[model samples]
Target: MSDPVRPGAVRAATLTRQPAFWVVAALLAAGAVRIAQITGRFLGVYPLATVTAMLLFALLAVPFWLFLSELDFLEREPASLRILAFAWGGLVATSVSIPGSNSLENLIAKLGSPNLAADWGAALAGPTVEEIAKTLGVVAIVLIARPQVNSVLDGVVYGALVGLGFQIVEDVVFAVGAVAQAGQGDQIQPVITTFLVRGFLAGVWSHTLFGALAGAGIGYLVVNPDRTRAHRLAMAGLALFGAWASHVLWNSPLFREGLGDGAVALLAVLVFKGLPPLLLILYLVRRAHDSEAAYYVAKLADLRDPVLITDGELRVLGSGTRRAAARRHAAARAGRRGRAAVRRLQRAQARLAVELSRDADPDLRHSAEVQRQRTALTELGHPEAVEGDPSWRHTVSTVGTTVVAVAVLWAALSFLGNG
Candidate 1:
């Protein structure tokens, strides 16, 4: 009996050790492979060229990802679902739409005249089909992951990611095509420059922006499902109209003529055309963020804790300085544990705050109340302190509005100057 028991215990210990060994081995293998690939790719090329391009892509993509992630706080959805939204845009949507549009254009050309086909391709094919296709990605996201999309901002962010993905892939193909067409002795500098300008700057307003605008309408429709059919139809119409208008203005020959004259035309398009819609979207996002903050603050009022969250504390929650101070205070008291708790509370508070801002159903209100109480118990000790004042809410709203307005104004002016 003793011999059998001893062997069993040893076997169990070995099994546990095996998993740990394998995990470490796998990680080491992955790292080694990555290093080898990087070294081999850069061996003959310019020392820092590949590295520089990667860094540039990271710089551009990371901010866009962060912006979308932040807006996600308002909706309270899973990251996986959000990514799925982007994947659908890039994969299924792009694949089907591109081929379908090409087929249709070819058919039209054969039936009519080649010049007529070219005219239709320029005016209708690019704007109508591409916008519809990209916007469908946003719609699919809303359909499949309804909970993830709460506002127009969410639509914009997701739509933008999809568009960005499409644009990046398309640009790569264009660059390679240019190189191939130019034949053996041609310099690739012109192709590279074209990729930078068209893929980076103009990409911002391309398919992604249009999809976002349309997505906002879709999100609004879904959010307000109780509306009359006529109202929903009207909103849908508006969304599609907004998307097509943006696409048309972006692809139109008027702007193309300006590019030849100087940077002025490009500047005009960016400022007068691009800045206004972007500003409008930002304004809407600010409102959503403020509303979310107010909801959580209100929920805390019911907790009755001792670490009284004053109107001032609520104000601090809205401002970066105040949040930092809270983190410092918590960290000082509890060290690492306290800091972690503070961060968790901050996120919880933000979520509950957003929930409270909306006139929630009874079930939602009750759920939020319970969560608020629990969070208060964990962080502030039981009976969490709560102070009431509507003015604090106003202050937060005012600050957010002012900040967004200033940003829009600055961008608009910069665009105008460039034009």
Candidate 2:
């Protein structure tokens, strides 16, 4: 009663407090700089070529985005945040890192043996600069919206998005560079070669994997409130080190040792060099997903409300294929309306699970959102029960088949291209 807050002061406070505002500002600034750089670099020289490369790589990025997006089934990040992460990776991180890395490489060459620098510059400077730059995007997202990355899986999703942006942009850059280097008036071949090697063969275990590893540490630091600060710092450091080590290994010349100059040798190089890290990251991602799913499922175990989420629904939600089958079944039963309602129900249930985990509250029926979604589901004629998730064996088999198919496709493309 003694003091009334001024309207201006209130508005200022609100603006300063909003993480979303800062995020938007960062994206705009970074995006402007990036657009300027791209225009300056390519507009005068290879305008159409650059555009074509960007468009092609962007189209390639879609499948990767979809694949990584599915990993965060419980709580997807907001579109605004996702866009911010991508922009930071593509615009901010790449913008700064390119010049910084080149300078570092030049410095190393001047100070030391140029031949040694030429051979190991990437292994040394690339990992240090690139990992930090990409990881910074994840850190920025966490700083702007602490709640967006509530689990390791959430971190991985955002990290992957950031890396995806960086990957696409970098691929385009490499393709353009290849075109210029060839100087043979045939840009298509160079572009295709770059895309085949970078976009297809090395896409899986590249910057995206490094960013995810680092982001997992950052997320663990932000989410686990009870952990001691020292422990959190250690986790953060360990993650960065892991990312740096992985990047170093990838860029190192060790893989070139015994590599021959044939298609089979190239395949062997990819498999031997890329497979171990790919397998390691896959294991880490799966474990992170399992931990998050278990946490949310445990929170919802006692809940039995059909409107909110049933145990059967919980099982289906954790598995991607089951979720798809459930939606298909609903569509088959009551047409598109049923499918839409089921989606709504699933989204609401996911949101509620997130809220429950945050508050550590099992009794979520009293939440307004819970009641509203429940009413919506009932009004739409609650979708039929979903079949349970497949056994671990089936899931593994499906995943393995998908991986094999992708590898075979890449090999076929390479074989055809050489032919």
Who wins the TM-score comparison? 2
C-alpha TM-scores of all predictions: 0.62, 0.82
What tens-digit string does per-residue lDDT give for candidate 2 at 1-419?
Answer: 01101001113355458776677577659766875777578756877677777778888888888787767776676766777777777777777777888988888898887997888998888888888888888887766566566677777788878888888887888888888898875357777777778887788888777788888777777777677899988988898898888888888887575765567767777777677767776776777777776766666665666556676787887766677777766666666877777776677676777666556564445355656755665666654447534446557778999999978766755663475
lDDT for model 1, please. 0.55
**In candidate 2, where is summed lDDT lowest over 10 consecutive residues?**
1-10
In candidate 1, stretches whose alpha carbon ends up further than 4 angstroms from where it belongs are: 1-59, 107-120, 184-191, 287-297, 300-309, 315-345, 352-419
Model 1, range 259-374, lDDT digits (tens) per residue? Answer: 54434555566566666556655565565456544445555565453343445556656544456555555554545665556555556555554444444432454455545544
Q: For model 2, which pairs clash?
A: none
**lDDT, each prediction:** 0.55, 0.72
